[model samples]
Structure formats: structure tokens, C-alpha cells
Target chain A: MKPFEDVGARAVMILSPGDNIAVAVRDIAAGEKVELDGRAVVITAPVLTGHKIAARPIASGERVIKYGAPIGKATAAVAPGETVHLHNLTSDYLPTYTLDEGHEFLKEQHQ
Target chain B: MTIQAYLRNDGRKGIRNIVAVTYLVECAHHVAREITYPNRDSGAHLIGFPGCFPNAYSFKMLERLCTHPNVGAVLLVSLGCEGFDKGRLLEAIRASGRPAKLLVIQDAGGTRSSVAEGQAWVSQTLAQLQNTPRVEMAIDELVVGTICGGSDATSGLTANPAMGRAFDFLVERNATCIFEETGELIGMEHWMAERAQNPALGREIVNTVAKAAKYYAIYGHASIGPGNADGGLTTIEEKSLGAYAKSGQSVISGIIKPGDVPVAGGLYLLDVVPDGEARFGFPNISDNAEIAELIACGSHLTLFSTGRGSVVGSALAPVIKVCANPDTYKRMAGDMDVDAGRILEGRATLDDVGREIYDLILRVANGEPTKSEALGHQEFILTYKSFEPLGPACFPSAA
Candidate 1:
């Protein structure tokens, strides 16, 4: 495999043949340079391992694909190598289930 | 496929001949625990719910567990007025052709005598089970379930899919494999439905996930935990994608609610969340609750994949721990059964690890104690929830 074809060269892994994002296999520091699929993309932010990074430039409102399926929608245009998380990506199907934010829904149940 | 088994009258074959001492309510837990304490190493297990209010879901769970292929005899400890339906439980056990004894704490002269009677009954039952006769059981007779606990980034990427591979292998061999937690499968149902055996079953799969989404939306939460984010999952959908990996690539045969046995021997989605409005808070309070439901569906053992490392095993069933993260495995190797984290290092492939897990299942079925089992981790829990009776489609041809 070519250096870029091997995602492990950049410490990332692609799950599916049709995935639009690759998961960081190791923490990639901001501004780090890595070659993905034969193209150079600079890490735009500190991306932690197991988190998604845009495999290509994704437009706002575009669905983020992982494991060859849509995981969520991009809230803002995300450049390749940009970390895709809560800031730029939000769940397309349901609201995020956070502990603090979800307390209100369970207030009466807890009481 | 044939192995030494204890055949129950109901046609269910047990891999272990254990005497289960169960408390009907939380009040009788002390006496019940004391009864099984002295014989902790004798395959005498303590299992019960702590609620006094009668719950149909709990009733069915206990009934199925008492008659689980692993249990040979059952001793029910009742507080007398806890509304746990002791008569129904005893009747279910007797119907299965297993020896059952119910000791009411109120009538058995309270705590001391109840413990004494329960201990005597357990010893007698154990002695009887020693001669209960072992029959030949086949691999197709085993029911297994998969669950993810304390998930991290590596879980979905490594351990879960490996478990999925194992599930696929077991399913092909005609073993029943169940994967649950609809609340966790929130967003993957659309794609997941396509993997079903038929269009109707696919629709049922989607509806179950949708029901979970609706149920959790009422409480504004998903089944994803706090440790999930720390391990790199950003949303429930992302987490579900990982959790879904445990189902493997087999066609989902049907969707069944808690306590509903699989109608066929193929992949079945377990709908853990209840229908209608969420009246009973969150569906599954912890990982053990899901395991209990899996056992209720006739699971002889469970495959538990943990990315963050969970050291729990079930009361009546052995749990094979598959660790997803190499780092966590290094720290908690004693509790894990498979080093699935090796996949992350590129040292092993999915098929290689999957085969390892599949072999472990057969070995454990043949009387090998899992790490959790030998360490004495028999965590059993049941919470109150209401399940609507499933119609014909849910049972398929085999249930």
C-alpha cells in the first residue's frame, strides 16, 4: 500500500470502504501534517484518538459518515483534517444525551 | 455438538446443575444471602429483586432464570407480604419438573428459621442434583447474548466488531445470538434494518429503535454513558455505531422484548426500552439489567465486550470478558478472557480474534470457568418495567 493509502501511516484508521471520516488511532496534535488518501491535510485542532477527523472537506448540513453510514450532520463547514465533534457535528436523529442537560427531563422521575 | 448436559423436563438442557436460592423481595435478601453464604463455592447462587411491588416483567425474568438450563433446583425466600407472586414462581418451577421449595420468612418463623430451612433445602437439593443425570446437549441448543459495558473508543473499533464476527459464526452454527440496548442503537436502525432476514422483521427492528429513541427523548437522554465521551465517542449515534458492531453481519431474525424467548435460531434484536411513555424512568439502570433480560430469553452464557474494562459476570450464566483497548487490557488482564485489543496494534485481524471468542464460548459451555466466574462475580439485577405482549411476528417460526 502507498504511504497515504495506508491510513496507519498517519495514525488513523478507516472503518468502511465508503466512510467519509477516519478515526484517529492516536492523539494528533493541532497543525500536525499528515497524508490521507494521497493528499496532504493539516490537523486543524487537537484530535484525540477514537474521535473522527474529516476525510475530506465537509459542507455545513452534510451528514458525517463513519462505519460507512451517516453518524450526524455537520453544523459548520469542516475542512479536511479538522476534528469533528460536538462543536462542528451534532446528531442528526436525536438530541445529545448529556448528564447535566438531561437532568430536566428526569427531574420529576428523580423526585 | 453434543456435550454433557442436565436435561430439564421443559426440554431445556442445562450446562450447569446449580441450586438457586432466591429472595422474593428486598426484605428477604439478608436471610437468602446467609443461606447461600456457606456454600458459596458449591454452585449455590443468590438471585432476587428488591422491590415489594409486583412487576410482571420481574416475575417472568425470575421464572425464566429459575428454569434456566444452568439451574437444577430453586429455593424461593419470601417476606410473605411483598406481592412478588411466590405461588406463580413456585408453580413455574414445578411445571418445569425441577425441585422447588418456597420458605416464607413470616411463616417459617422469621429470619433465623427461614435461613435454616433454606440452607437445609439447598443442601438436599444439591445432593439430589448430584444424581440428577447428565444428558447429551448439542451446540444448537445454546442461547448466547452480547453486551457492551464501560465502552471506550477502541470498543466499537475493535472488540465489538470482533464480537460481531463471533456472533455471525455462532449464528451460522444454529446458535441463538441476542444483541440488545435499543436505547444505544438510536440512529443506526435505518442501516441495521436492511440486515434483517425479511422486510417485516426489518421494520420491527426500526420500530424498536424508534421506540427507544422516543422513550429516551421523553427523559432527554440516550443510553451512552459519560465514559463513552472520554473514550472519544462524541454522540449517541457514534456510540450506537460501535455498539451495533456486536450484532455482526447476520440478518436480524426478529425483535423481542424482555422475557420474550427467540422464536427462531438467528440474530434477534432485544428491545430493552419499554413502549409508550417512559413511566419507569430509564429502561436499563446498568449493564447487569440487560444481562438479566438476556438470561430471561434463555441465554446460557453472555459475551461482554468492555473498552473501559467492566469486571462483572451474571448470577446463573458465565460471562466471557472481551477487552477492546490494549491499554486497559494491560491494566486489567486478570478480568478479561480475550485480548481483542491486539487488533488495534495490527497484530491480529477480526477473524482471528473472533475465532478465539467463539472457541471460548464452546469451552465455557463444556464446563470451563471464565475469569469472572472463578473470581466469584455473579452480579444479578432487575428493575421494574412494563412490556407489551408481542404479537405473532416477534416469535418467528422457532420461539
Candidate 2:
């Protein structure tokens, strides 16, 4: 059987079918070659571990897919073999509370 | 493996027989802590609510904790004039056929004398607990809860799925498994409901998640922590998909609010975010708060999975820490029990780590110390909140 790492983010992982990105398991320097689906693509930027790599080309405002579902929307045009993160994509859902805000909110309520 | 257990009146079995020192309000906290801290070597731990304001949720959580199967006795400390319901709490503990006592600080001659009196009583109760009868405890009678903390990309990819596989094993053996934090289960509510034994139970799952969403929105926030984004999670939906894997593939039998016990053994979801307004702030201030709720609901032991690393155990129940990231495990090996990160490294498969967790539960119940227990990591917390009792639709299997 193929090792589970090949399917996981050891090098890269596609979480679900028809998804737009794969997670980088290790940091790959630019100009290096990485496998995607069946073919090889040369890295355009230094991709960090745990960051997303574009599975295909997409236009701005397009939904970014991970785990086969929309995690967020692209803020700018993302090309294949590029990294996906806060610098490119943004969260569709806002955070419920921050660490500092929670402290303040708790203080106000109890006081 | 069969475990020699402590039988309870409710037909539940306890793995640890502990004496709990409870402070009814914050004013009595110092004296209560002093009474318990030194004797903690003999199985004492401090747990209580600090709020002087009366809260039905805190009251119920206190009742559940004092009567928990893991707790063999309790010492109640109260500073008079607080809004907490001390008498009702004492009655519940006594009703459970365990030793329980209440000391009002003002009547007991203030903090110094009261500490002396509380110490004597704790000593007496602990001696009595040594006589509690031990019978046979088996896997089928076990109730387990899984929680994810400091989650990161590795959490969903490795540790959570491993936990899910272990959960599947427990459910098959007729054990009750509980997975919670509906706030984190934001995007996959419909998928979760479809796995419920009955259709109405599914709808309850949907409603509870919505309650979490609405509750968080009012507070101008979401459940995903900062560590989550630092580890590459971008949205609540992405974090949720990772969080939901802990339940495995069992058909959910019930949905419960905090402090509500299960009627039968199967998979259950705890609806933690409260009903009504977001006045109490965040539903769970930290991971320990959720762990406390699980102990209050009769969990014999808890499975804690973390990606960024968490070192917390609990006051009444043993907590097993499952580490998700290989790198994190290497850094905090002493604090973790199982390295589920082996799944992603290909050193092990999901089943390998899953079986490892299942084995750890049996060994811990039979008196083997988990990494948390051995390291003396018993942490506890409870806060004020409100809730309406979960409805019949939430527990259709019991009907």
C-alpha cells in the first residue's frame, strides 16, 4: 500500500476532490519542482509548511476550496504553484473574540 | 481488560475515588485552597465558582461535580451572604451516598479556625473513602469525552482522525462517547445531523450549532483561536471540519447541555454555548472549562488532543493528552501520552495511533498513570452562564 504520507501533507496534500488548493507539508524554496495531481509544477515562491498552494489558477473574489469546501475567498488573483494565505486569501467568517477583548469583556461583565 | 472499580448508586463505575474541596463563593476560596493544597498528596483538589452572583448553570455544574463518580467525598466552604445555593448543593452530595460537609466561615470562627476544622473533616472523609467497595468496571460501562485544544493544521489532519477512529472502537463496544463545542462545528452541522440515530436528533444538532454561531456573533467573535490562524487555519468552517473528526463514524444517540447525564451508552454531542444573550461573554473561556463540564457529566476519563500543545488535566477525572504535531511532540514528550503525529509521518497509520489511545484508556482505568496524572496537572475552571434544559428532540433515543 502507498504510505499515508503521500496522501497527507508530507510534501503536499489535496484534502478533498474538486478542491482548489493543497497544503504544504514542508517548506519548499522557489524554483523547486513539486508534484500536483499527475504533473510537476515549478514553485514560484518560497512556500511555507502548513500554508496552502493553489491547485489551479483562479480569479479574484473566487471561493478558495480546502477539505473540499470553501474556507474563504481569494482577495487577489492566485496562480497555480503559488502560496495561499492571509497575504492572498481572507476569512469569510470573522473571529468571535480576541484574547484581549475577552479579558475586557469578562472584566466589564463581572465588575 | 477488566478493571476493579468503585460502584455508584446510579449504576455508574468510577476509576478514581477522590475527595473534592469545593468553595461555594470566591470569599471562601483562600481558606478552602489552604485546606486542600497540602493534603493533595492524599487525593484532594480545589474546585469552585468565584462569582457571588447566583447562576443556575454554576449551581447545576456544582451539583454534578460533587456527586460525580470519581468523587468519593466533598468539603463545602461558604462565606455567608453569597448568592450560591449551599444547602441544595450539600443535599445533592449527601444524596449520592458519599461523605459531604458544609462550613460557613463566619460561624466557624473565621479563616484561621475554619481552615483547621476543614482539614480535620477532609482527613476524616478521606479515611472513610478507603472503605468504599470496589467491584468490576468494564469497557462497556465507560463514558468518554474528546476535546481539541490549541488546534492547528496537524490537528485536523492527524490527531483528530486518530481520535475518531478510537471513538469508533469504543462505540462498537457499547461505550458512550461524547464530542462537543458546537461553536467549532459551524459548517458541518447538516453532515453531523445526518449521522444521528433519529431525524429530530439531527435537527437538535443543527439548532445547537446555530446557537453557537449566534452567540459568538453577538460577542463580535468566533471560536477559532489565534493559535489556529498562526498554524494556518483561516476560517471557522475550516477549523470546524477538523474539529468534527473526533466523533468518528458512530451514529449520534443524544445531544446534552452541560451537567446533563446520558440515559444510555452511545455517541453524544454537548451543546456548550448557552441559550439567550451573550452576556456571560465566551461560552468556554478556555479548554479547561470544557474539561470541567465533561467531568460534571460523569466522564470517567477524558481524551485531550492538541496540535500546538496543551498540558492540562482535570480535578476529578484523568486526562489523556494526544499530541498531533510530530515537532510539538518532540518538544513536549513528557507532557503527552500518545503521539498521534505518527499518522502523518507514515511511521504509523490512523488505526495504529487509534488502537494506542484505546489501550491507554484501559490501562489508565486499571490504575496506570497518564502523562497528565503523573505530572500532577489537575486543572479546573467554571464560569457563569444560562441555559434552558435540552428538549426531548435532543434526546429522542431515550424516549
Candidate 3:
């Protein structure tokens, strides 16, 4: 296996070729421009390291691809460089469990 | 490569000769804990099933654990009135040709006396274990298991895949490698099935993951938790892909449930989810439960990958913690054995960290203490579960 540096020197990584999202290898600040493929994609929001960023615009209800497979569906239209997380992307399987502001168990269901 | 190991009468080898102080029910836990406290640094580990009611799964798990290769001897602590079958468990332990003793807290004059007697037995057993025969144990004689917990996205990108690389190395050497947590592999079934040794085994693999999915669905929760979401894992499918990377690229040789030891050396997938209806609350209550299941299946040691950072180690087996997130690694360096996050930082390649893990496994097998072991993290947990016998396709390669 080649070193990760051989892939690219970008702050974000596209795990697989067909993946429409890139994972932040480092914490990326909002409005920071990072190159994906040959084009520059501006970060719309601050993305933490190990979080996902939209590589390209994704339509609502479209499958969100990662690890070369569909991880879930986009809950709403997503712009390039947007953070793809529980707020915008929902699991196609069971609901993701979370806590409400009051620390009560909240089952976040897919839209 | 070979390391000096304790050879059991059953022909299995062990890296540690641990004297297990086990309680049969929740009532006896305190007495058992007291018995093992003085010998905390001497390999006398406290492990038990807390359920007062009888469960066949817990009984089998305890039996397998008592006779596990790593365990040198066992001391059973029972409350006398509890429903756990202490007699059968003691008999099974003695039948394995290991020193076994039982302390009935009621008949032995309750808590104080039971604790005293149990401690005496533990002290004696630890001494006797020193005489266990040392033999040359090769890599093929090893049974290694992998599980990912407290996972983040870097877990898949770094530690999980690095562990996968290490698993591939061990499998290539003809060692037994087991990766589990079917619930975490919900969406990767088809991808995993394609790597099975046979079409039938492939089908069985698919069905196993389906069972996990159904079980989790019944509880209205995927295995993904708030901690997982906090670490940026959105869906169970996304987490599944990350968790699945720990299996490496080996052709999955078989599927075995808890306490079902693989008959031969190869890569195996441990089916941890219960078989029947979703009577159990969750497949595994926590990561330690899964670690206990792996130990019951005869793993000499376990590879634990984490990005969010977990400090747990097992009673019978040594856990090599691979920190996946670079920031987490920085925060929890003392708790981790391998910093797989170096791959993410471009400081090391996957192969580099993979080799580091593989080398550490050998060193740990040769009697080197892992970070957790040195820190006294012998955490163990077991609970109720039911499983039907494995279908023939589950272990086609096993004799």
C-alpha cells in the first residue's frame, strides 16, 4: 500500500473514487477553500477532523456515498463543501439515537 | 516466529497463566472481588455473571472462560441460593485438568469467611500456575480477535484499516483471526459475503448480518450511539463500513458464535448477536461484553481499535489499544499501544502502523505487557443471550 501522502496533500480526503463526500483529515475552518479533483471547493462551514464534507452538490433524497457505497440519503439539498452530518444526512437503516438539549433520549428519524 | 507459552492439556497455548476468581451470581460479586483485590497485580482476575437467574448462554460462556487457554486455574464463588449452576461449572473446570475450587458463601460462613477462603485459593492457584509447562508457540497457534469501539471516521481511515492490515498478516501466516460485532456490519453484508471462502458461507454471512439488523431494529436503535454521532459517524451504514475495515482483506473462513472455538486456524467472523427473537435488550450491552465473547471463543489476545478512546482491557486476554484519531492519541497516549493515527497525519503509512501492530502482538504474546495490562484494566462483562447451533455452511473449512 502506498502512503496517504501519495494520494494528495489536501486537508480533506476522498476515501474512494465515486464518493461524493470527503473526510476532513484536519480541522477545516469555514470559508477555507480546498481542492477536490482539479477544482476548488470552498468550505461552507467549519468541519471537524474526521467529519465529512460534501465534495459536490447533492440533491435531496439522493444517496450519500462513502467507502464507495451508499451510507445514507441526503435529507435536504446539500451544496459543495457543506458538512454532511446528522443534520442534513439521515441513515437509511435504523434511526440515529441522540440526546435532546435537556439530555433526554431522542431518536432522530429519517425525513 | 515462535514465543514461549503455557501449553494446556487440550493442546491450546496461552500467553498468560491467569488464575480466574469467578462469581456465579450478582450476590457473590463482592466476595469474589475482595478475593482478587490483594492479588490484583498477580494475575488473579475477578470475572462473573451478575444474573441470579439461570441462563444457558452465561453458563456456557463461564465454562469456556474457566477452561480458556489463558486461564491456569479457577475458583468459583457462589451465594448458594442463586440459580446459577455452580456445581456443573466447577465440575467442568476440574474436568479440564486445571486446579478448581468452589466457595459457597452461605455454607462457608457468609461474606467474610467466603472472601478469606476464596483469597487463599487464589493465592495458592497463582503460585501453582508458575509450574505450567512452557512450550514453543508459533504464530499459527495464535487465535487473535479484533473489535472496534468508540469509533470515529478516522477509525476506518486509520486504526481499523491498520488492524485489518495486521489481521491480513496474521491470516497469511495461517493464524486464527476473528473479527466480530455483526450489528456494526449492517450495510456491509454483501461486501463481506463476497470475501467468504464459499458461496454457502457467503450466504450464511449475509443472513448473520441480517439477524443483527433485525435485532437492532426491534430495539428501535442501530448500534450507533450519541458518542458515535459526536465523533461524526452519521448512519449505521457509515459506521458499519468503518467497523468492517478491521476484518482486513482475508477471505472469511467461518462464522462461530460465542464459546464456539474454531476447530482450525484461519479467519473467522464471530456472530455475537442472539439467534431467536429480540428478548435481550441489545446484542452486546458494551464493548467489554463483546471482548468477553471473543475470549470465550479462545482468542489469546484482542486488538481494540478506538478513535473516541476507550481504556478497557479484558480479564483473560490482553487488549492492544490502537488509537485512530491523532488528537485522541495525543490525549490518551498512555492508554494506547499503537498510534494508528499516524497514518492519517501522513507520518506513517498503513503498512507501517500495521507492521507495528503485528510486531506488538508478537511482543505481547512473548510476555510483554500492553499499556492497559500495565494500568490494571482487566475489565470483563457477560450477559444473557441465546444462539442456535452453527449451520454447516458457517464453518465449512473447520474439521
Maximum-TM-score candidate: 3
Tens digit per residue, CA lDDT, model 1, A34-65: 77777888887887767788888899999888
What is the TM-score (0 to 1) of candidate 1?
0.93
- Misplaced by over 4 Å in model 3 are A1-9, A101-111
> lDDT rank, highest first?
3, 2, 1
> What lDDT does each candidate get?
0.84, 0.84, 0.89
> How many backbone overlaps does candidate 2 show?
5
Tens digits of lDDT, candidate 3, A66-90:
8688999999998888899988898
lDDT of 3 by residue, B214-314 (tens): 89988888998888898999999999998988998989999999999987888999999998888869989999999999999999999999999999998
**Cα-based lDDT at residue B97, candidate 2:** 81
Write model 2 residue lDDT over B219-325, tens digit each, in one string. Answer: 76678766887777767888887888888988999999899988688999998898887777899999999999988777889998998999998888999999988
Model 1, B1-399: lDDT tens per residue?
457778777777877778888999999999999999887678899899899999888898999889888999999999999988899899989999999998999999988888888898898889888887778777777899999999987888788989999998989988899999998898888888888777777788888888888887776666766687678777789889889889998888888888877755888888888776678788988999999999888888999999889999989988999998888999999999999878777778888899999988888888889999999988988889988888666655543
Q: What is the lDDT of residue B44 in candidate 2?
A: 87
Q: Looking only at chain A, give the TM-score of model 3 against the true structure.
A: 0.81
Give, for candidate 2 chain A, the lowest lDDT window spanning 10 residues. A1-10
Model 2 residue runs over 4 Å out of place are A1-9, A44-48, A96-111
Worst 10-residue lDDT window, candidate 2 chain B? B4-13
For each candidate in turn, the interface RMSD (Å) is: 3.7, 3.4, 2.4
Q: Regarding TM-score, does 1 or 3 come out ahead?
A: 3
